[model samples]
Structure formats: C-alpha cells, structure tokens
Target: MNLRLYDTAARSVRDFEPLQPGRASIYLCGATVQAPPHVGHIRSGLAFDILRRWLQASGYDVTFVRNVTDIDDKILQRGTDEGIPFWQVAMRNERAFTWAYDQLGCLPPTYEPRATGHVPEMVELMQRLIDAGHAYPADGDVYFDVRSLPEYGALSGQRLDDMQPAADSDAQIKRDPRDFALWKSAKPGEPQWHTPWGPGRPGWHLECSAMASRYLGPAFDIHGGGMDLLFPHHENEIAQSKAAGDSFAQYWMHNAWVTTSGEKMSKSLGNSLLVSEVVQRVRPVELRYYLGSAHYRSMLEFSDEAMSEAAAGYRRIEGFVRRAEESLGMPESVPVPDAFAAAMNDDLGVPQALAVVHDTVRVGNAALAADELVGAREARDEVVAMLDVLGLNPYAPPWAAQSDDGAARRALGPLVDVVLAQRAAARDRKDFAVADALRDGLAASGIVVEDTPAGPRWSLAEEI
Candidate 1:
C-alpha cells in the first residue's frame, strides 16, 4: 500500500517514497524541558505517531528520533528565580513529560538524545559550517552567515531582504542583521561546555541538526514539528546543515498548532490545558480521538463541550466494535475492503477511513442481527484491524492497568500494617465516610479496591 503524506515543502500531498526501500527515518523536534506537556505539545507528536503507525502497518521499519532540549533560555530564567541550577529544572520537567507521554499512549522514540548530552556532536557540526565559510565566529560567538546559504529563505518562503532585524545588533560582529546564532559563547553562571572555540552552549537550531545527524544520519526521510517552527527554527536547520555539506531532511511535515477560543494555545496565554489535568477529566483514548479527529493542518479547539462531542463520536466506534465482538462469537476472519485501503492511501484521510469502519460495523451488525454469521465474521476482522491502525479499539476501556503491582504493595511492610489498623478503627467507630472515600479515590486513580472474601484487597484496574 502506498502512503501519501502532506509535505509542507510542496504545500500539497504526495506519495511517501522512503530513501531506503522498505524503511523510514523520522526526526521530530521534541519539547524544551522547561515545562510539562499541554494538549498543544501532544498534538504534533500524536499526529506523527499516527503516521508512524500507518507506515509500520504497511511493513516499513521505522526509526523515530525525538530530541529533548535541556539547555534553554527559559530554563535559565526560571532557575535564576528559584535559586537552583537550570539542569535540575530540565530533569524535573523531563520526567513530567515522560509521564504525560505514557498517559496518552504515544510510543517511545528509538533515541531520546538530550541536547546537553551531545555537545561534542554539536561542536563538530559548528566546525563544519565554519570551515565551509557558511558560519563565522566573532567575539567567541559563532553565527551562521545567512547570505552564504543561497536557499536560506526557500523553506520558509521569506526573503532575506524582507526580514526585518529582530533586534538591534552590536554593529561590530554580524555582517548582516539576518544572521542567527549557531553557538553562544559562555556567559558567567550559564550552562557551558568546552568547545574548539571556547566554553559555550549550542544554539536552538544547531541542537536538532546534531542530534538528528548522530542518530538517523545526514539525511532522513521526514522531519516534523509544530507549524510555528517552519520559520526561523526549521529554516535555520536547513541552512546550517546544507551549508555544512550534509543533506538534511528529505520531507518536511508540520502539523497545525492546537488552538483554544479561536487562538493558538500557548503558555504565554495562560489558556493551555495540561495533559495530566486533562487525563483526569477525559480518558486518554477519548482525548486522542478528540485531538486527532480533524485534518493535521487544521486547528483543534478543545473544551469540555468539544470533548463531550468527541466522546459521542468515539462511542459510536466503541459501540460498534463491542456489539460486533459479542454477536460474532470472536470470529477469526475479517475481510478487507478496497474502500478502506483507498481512504488510508489518500493522504492518510482518517475521516474517510473512519467512514469505512463505521460502514463495516453497519453491515456487520445487520448480518449478526439476521444471523448471517459468516458475513459478520469478515466485518469483525476488518473492524479490529481498522481499530488497531487508528490506535483506538472502541471495546477497550480507557483506564486499564498493564502491570501487576501486588508484590510491591505487599512489600510496603509496616505501612500495610498501619493502614490495616486504621481500617479496623474506622469500622469500630462507624466513621465509614473516610474509609469509603479513601477506597473510592484509589479506585478512581486506576487502583481497584476489592472487598474480597478474606479482606480488603486492592489491585490495578484493567488498562485500556
């Protein structure tokens, strides 16, 4: 099956032909670890995750690389306020992001190269640019010479003459105001590493190039991130890498930013919905469905009302899969429809693919109702595969536990005895509300409180 993806380069959809036959290489610019993930953060990754799923489903070996930016101006600014090292802030937020990613069912990347972990690679890349005369070092700071790269504005479609200088420069080092930083010379108390030039840190655009090249190679199949990065961030990456004599990304993919109240969601707006808080309100799979229901280039507005609407649509798919599974007696066979393949092949049109799934359910349900068990069997199999491809199996409950935690619970030792004593005291005093609330709260957070015949035993709920 041919995979058609929307390439931001062409501003149109095109068939995806891997550089290496039957394989894919992808580099996704990950979050800067200054804050935890919000709904907006997940949108870009989940969109590409869907693309990864489809490619794998079509028998492509996928190597996905997502980089973590540990060193940033924001982390330094916040750290200065808190009186702690900026690296500490980065580590704390990186763990928070890992939790958010797991809650949303995103696959772990093959390599999660932290920017701080790859300074040597960054120094090497900077040297290539400098040696190529595309970058020049002045006053210990290395700046990319935008004029040296003729195709600088080709990706962003912004000409150098039209770009206004962001801020007034010192007027001594930079030949053109349009030139951006490749490496920043170390300032006192800032995070720094010893480089060929001096002690300094890598710039934002240079980090991705170094990390991507180290993991995936000089050229990869696709590079994706939020549409906001299409400008200076990704454009600089293209300029810096090509100037260094390495072919950068072959295909560029950018998903539209998630919006709220008719505006793009951003930390600066104070309107962002954190992923952890959202997971508390809406199930992860439901949230995924809501975020992914529209075209990748379209803005997704999320609210309680929007979530409820998505749940309604998702419930339809869930209801169909559930009924089909029950009535068909777990049929092993499912027929693939030409319509299903065609829809997916057409720029990965999820909406059209969904229509085929629902159509299968319609015919599958009717056949089951009429006792046409054989026809129902084929439909059931097709629905299963479709759900698998979409990462949403309607029948699976949202909050299911995937681990056996009984041994760890038993190892609590003295804490378990103390809790048991408290439970007995609560029963004797008739203060059942505290006891009940404790049990119920645990159950709500994916812990199942079971009043077994022996005693109160707790375990994890079924993981969806």
Candidate 2:
C-alpha cells in the first residue's frame, strides 16, 4: 500500500513521493525552550517519530531535522521573571524537552539545530529577501514586505487585507502593518547579533526558514509542527522562504493539539500537564502508546481516565509478548501483518494499527492457552514487529529494562531460583504431587516456567 498522508497545504491525503527517490527529509519545529514540555508538546514528536520509522521501514533513507528556538520572546521573558539569564532558561528547558523525547523512545533527529547557533544563515536569508525587494530595513529593524508577495497568505489561506496586523514589531517602523519582522533590534539586557540591518536577534519565523535551508537545503520533503503553527508562524516562514527563492518544503504536515475541555492545552490555560508529572503516573512506553494511539490529525482529549485505559491496553500487549518469549525461547523478527501495514500506510492511522496489535495479542494468547507454542510465537513476532514501527516495542532499548523495573526483575530472579530448586528437589524425591502443586502455585502468582535445553527458565506471566 502507498503511504498516503494528509498534507495541510494540499488539504487532502496524497501519496508520499520523495523529492529524491529513496530519500526523505523532514523538518519539525521543535520546542521554544521557555519551560519544560507537557505531554501535549511531546505528542507531535511521537507522531513524527512514527512517520520517520515508517519511512525508514519502507526503504527510505530519512534525514530528520528538528529545530530548537533557543532565543525567543518567551525565553527572554522567562529569564526576567526568574532573575536568570535568557540563555540559562533556554538551556534548562531544552534539556527537559530532550529528556522527555528520549524517555518516550523517539529517535534523535539527524540535526537538532538551535536558532541562535544559525544566525549567519538567518542573516543570509534576510539579505536575500531584501535584495529581492521583499524585505526592508528600518530604524534598526528588518521586516518582510508581505505586500510584495502575492502568495503571502497562501499557506494559511488568508488574504492580507482581511488579516490582522503582523504585530511582530512596531507598526510605525514597518512598510505595511502586515509585514512581519525578519529581525528585531536588540533591547537593553538582551542578546544581540550584528547584521547589516542592525544589531539584533533573528525573528522567530526567520530562524526556521534559514535553519531548514541550511541543513535540508533549498527544498525538503516535509515540514511539520502542531496545527496551532499554521497561522502567522508558518505563514510568515512560507512568505519569507518562497520570496527568497527557495522551493522550501514539498509537504506541510501538522499534528492536531492535545486539548482539555475542548480548549488547547497551554501554560497560560493552567491545564497543561508536564511530561515529568505524567510519566510518574504511567510508564513511559504506555504514555507513548496513549499519545500515539490517535490519528495525527485528530485531537487527543487529556484526562486521567483516558490515560489509565491506554496504559491498561499496553499492559495487555506487553503481557502477551513477555509470555510468548518465555515459551518460544525469545522471539525472532517477523513481518508485520498486511492489515497492520495497511492501517499504517493510511496516513499513520495509529488507532487502527493498535486495534490490529491487540487482535494479534488475543490470537497469541489463545494459542498459548491451547499449548500451541509455534502459533503463539508467530502471533507474538508479528505483534512485536508492528510495535517496533510504532516505537512501542517493550523489549527495545531505552524502553527496555528501565531502572526500577530492572531492579525489581533482578531481585525477583533469585527468589524464583530458590522456588525452582525446591520444585526440582520434590521431583527428584519422586514427590510428583508436591512438585506439581508448587509449579501450579507459581503460575497462579504470574510466574511462568519453561524447561529448555539450558534449564528451567522463568518469567513474569504479567509484565512488570
């Protein structure tokens, strides 16, 4: 099946064809780093991660670039509010976002460029826009001449006359109220960079256009961010990049927001749940499953009930995988089921894909119940392969053997060994009934034993 994705610019699902055959490039707008990210913030990361994995699985050499807006208005404000340097605030929160992404098993990007580090590129882009008569420098500030580009509002489908003022800078300094800033003049106690326009930092939109072009070239396969960015943020990026004579992104993909009470979750709303807080309530893998369980274009309503339910669902899948591994002496790789592949191919329909995973788990459980080890192994391997694509594989690194879980398993292993010795001694003395009872009791307590060529190995019947 073809990978058909919902391109926001096209406003419809279209088959994904890379600009370069066997190669895919993606630029995802990452954190601004004013504060630690909430689950809502990480949802986009997980969604795009699945997309990257799917592309690689389908034989594409993927170049994924996620950028950090380290020096922004919000970060500067945060620093003033906390009596710290803006750079300090940016670093603290950027590390938090990185930890959250890694905890959820999202693959690291090929290049995670910081906006501040690419000022030279931003300066080049601004110069190009100015040279093309699409931008102007005034009073130590540079503004994109929105009126010069007829396609200024094409990305967000808004006409310049009908739109609100750009509000990115002082209206008196701009050629047109709709013209957003390409650079902002430095203020007292704020970071500054020297550019032809004046001594100032790069504008928010200007940073992405420059960074994307620098790393991914003049054009890339996909540009992605949360749906909220579709307005002025992405709109301005398109205007400046296209006006500067770059092909820019071939496809625009936006992930829907995670909302609470039908409102977008935000720090201002006082409804945002931090990633660190939520992970304390559920395992990281389960949190990932919950976040990625919905279609990328669909809103995920935040709630404890919904999150708990998702956790339980993942536990069921994890339980089956653990059991199957004990009986089969470790699962080998298996092809994902056609139904699972089809679901993923259809715009990364993770809900449908998860339904397929659970169904396979049920089949594997039934096979195990009937002592059909071969059938069980087949179902387990397929489920694992599918999970691998979704980044939910319980046995994979990062998610595998977490500190507390590993400690618990390591402590339990010795106790189980003692019980196995008792059972073995009972069988050696020909006390078959006592040995059977001990084995049955252990099984009742969620421990499964398998006699292998090496020895009798044991594992938790239910995943930890």
Candidate 3:
C-alpha cells in the first residue's frame, strides 16, 4: 500500500508500514466519559473510524482498540454532584457516547476495554517500571521519575527543563515536580484498587498505557487521540512506556479539535453543542458528513450555517444515489475513483476526496438526465465505493434503517390524525380541559401538534 500518514512524532507524512505484514494494530485514547459527548468529542472517533475503514479497504487486517477511562476524578465528582456512585456516572455517559457514535455511523472498535477492568495489567506495568528504576513510590503514591527517560519529550517536541510540574498528585513526595503519578493513593470515599506500593487508583496517563499494552502488546503500529492530549497526556505515556523498556507505539496521530466562535468546543467553555441536540435539527448522516468532510488535521469550526450547508451537500449525494438505484437497480461495488484513492492516501485528505464524490454525483445526475444508464451506473458505483470507505454509504445497515423509520412515520400519520380530530371536537364543545389533555397526551407520545390556520397539524418529535 502507498498510503502515507502524517506521523505527529516524526512531524511528516511517511509511508505506512505495518509492524507485521498484512496486520495493523491501533490503540486510540477514547472517551473519558464524565459527561455526554458533544460534536467536539466524537470528531476524533469519526476521523479514526474513516482511517480504520481505509485500512480495511487497502487489505490490511486491523485490530483496533479504543479504551474507555471509566475511572476518573471528573467521574467521581459527577457522581458526588448527582448523589450516585462513580461507576453509575461512567456507565451512563459511556452509553451516551456510544449512542452518539452509532448515530453518526461510526463502526465499533475491535475491542473497547475499560480501565477499571485491567487493574492487573496496570499493576504488572507498574512493577516493570519500578524494577527498571524508572519509577518510585512515596507517601502511598507512585510517580514516574521523568529524569530517568532521557528521550522523554521526543514525541511532543518539548524540552524537559521548560515543562510544567505534573500536578496530578502531591508535589512534595515526588523526587521531581515534573515526575507524574503512576498511581494515586486512595482518598476517603473514593474507589481504590490494591497495588504493590499501596491501595490507590491508576493515573490517567497510566491507564491508557496499561490498556494499550495489554491489548496491542508492549509495542504497536499506531497511537491516536485528539490534539489537545499532545502535551502532558501523550508525552507522559511515551515517557513511562518507553522507560519501562517497551518500544511502544511506532507512529502517533492526533486529530485537530472542533471550535466554536474561535474557542475550542468544550463543556468547560460553555460552548459545546451536544450531539443528541444537533442531530435533531438535521439527519444523523448529515451530521457525520459535516464532521468528516474536513481534513483530519485541520480544525473544524462549528456553526449552524456551516452545518446547514454541509447538510445540503450530503442531501445532493443522497438524492443522486436514490435516483441512480431506482433507474439502474443497486450499484455494483467497484473500486473508488483514482483521484479519491490518491487523496485518501495522502494523509486521509477527506475534503479533497469529498470533492471527488461531489464531482461524480454531478456526472451521475447529468447521465440520469440524459437517460444514459451505462454512464449513470459507472458513476453510481464509483460514488458508492468512495462513500463506503468513508462510512457514508446510504444503502448500508444503520443508514438503511432510516427507510424503515420513514415507513413507520407514514403509518403513524393517520393514527395521529384521528386523535387530532377528537381533540378538535373537544375544543368545539367548549371543553378546554379535555382538548388540552389530548394535546398533552400527544406531546408526551412525541407527537407535536400545531393549531395552524389550515387546521391542526401533527408531526413526530425530532429524535437523536
């Protein structure tokens, strides 16, 4: 394969060579599900999902591991706020993240491990680091002695002297202020696991290193996460993992963030638009297109106007696909256009690839207009092939389910009409309470009723 990926570590687009021929291993730092996902949170998943699909299309057997940090300080805090257990908070938010991923049409990872489930692996890893004299325990907490790893900042291109102290735990016990925690000693009312050093919880950086090594082995082909993690999170992972004598990830990839109004879209910023809410305004597939249309490395600025334009673009493609299918039957799977492949090969350049999709759609529409089946079919097949690689194929499983929903909506219309008629009669009889009750019942059932000038109009509520 001639695919080239921009290695964040190397800071260049390099040819992708699997560790073992025909097999690729990836460990992506997944959700730290303390809260429900926003568009910013799922963009990384969508970006990597496209990469995984492309690798499969390129004939590589891929083992993808996306770990969930089910134990975290934020999770515990959220639990405290809600008067629930930390695990409950984690599980609830994790489900929300999963629903968002599925609604956006992301494929499931090969294995989605939780940090809490791999305490044994983390213990073993800590032992390895301790034995290597790269880590030490003090005051019931363990810290990775950053000085021990001479190549500590290679991945993130930072100098050890200029780095800030890792405030993950108490600084007084650490030999160096920069020495980050491998494990934090238990506090009152917080969950704890037994470790050789003491009873405590795994550090954020440590959990990912442990999970990745456990699933993909000590060393793997690629490690990916959002760009914000480059500093302390990813750099610390490199320091401890390599200090323990594992070669660790061969390549690093980081997707840029989604921003709104020149600020990063984050809950702390109070500017995050929830995925569940956004999908109500547009189809889930349209949201996917908007998120996935940009180059993975480029920052995507979020706005309603931009989203509307993206939805229109996706609708054009969908309209062409539906029309082509009606005339030529289902398009046979074929190789994507060379232009599309070349764009994808060059660092997963999706924007250029999407231009190709739009170009093909235009040609297909023209062919359909001229009553040319052969040309239309060729264009249709090429478009399907490209969309399939990008996980935007409309006729595929999850998106195809929308057709069934359309039929259900059609069936629901008459039933809702009958109720509205009864509601109208109640209103005409001067029984305001009965009419109000009927309207409220329909609203509770996700049917919105509007008393328009033409009469009563009903529609189903928007679904995430």
lDDT per residue as tens, model 1, 1-464: 57788888788888898999999999999989988889999988888877787788788999999989998889988899899999999999998888877666677888999999998898999888888899988888899999988888999888999987778564468888888888989899888888878888888889999988999999899999999999989999988888888898988999888888889899988889899888787678778888877777788877888887887777666655655665566545333477877777777777788888889888987887787878877888888778766667543323334222446666753554566567657867999987777666666666665563356655544333
**Candidate 2 structure quality by residue, lDDT tens digits, 175-226:** 7887888898999888899988779987789999999999999999999999
TM-score for candidate 2: 0.90
Clash totals in order: 5, 0, 0
The parts of candidate 2 lying over 4 Å away from their true place are: 166-169, 403-407, 416-464
TM-scores, all candidates, are: 0.84, 0.90, 0.88
All models: lDDT? 0.81, 0.89, 0.90
Q: Find the candidate with the highest TM-score and give its number.
A: 2
Superposed model 1: Cα runs more than 4 Å off: 168-172, 329-336, 394-464
**Number of the predicted model whose lDDT against the real structure is largest:** 3
* Residue clash pairs of candidate 3: none
Q: In candidate 1, list every pair of residues with a backbone clash.
A: 400-462, 400-463, 400-464, 401-462, 401-463
TM-score of 1: 0.84
What is the Å distance of residue 31 in model 2 from its true position?
Answer: 0.5
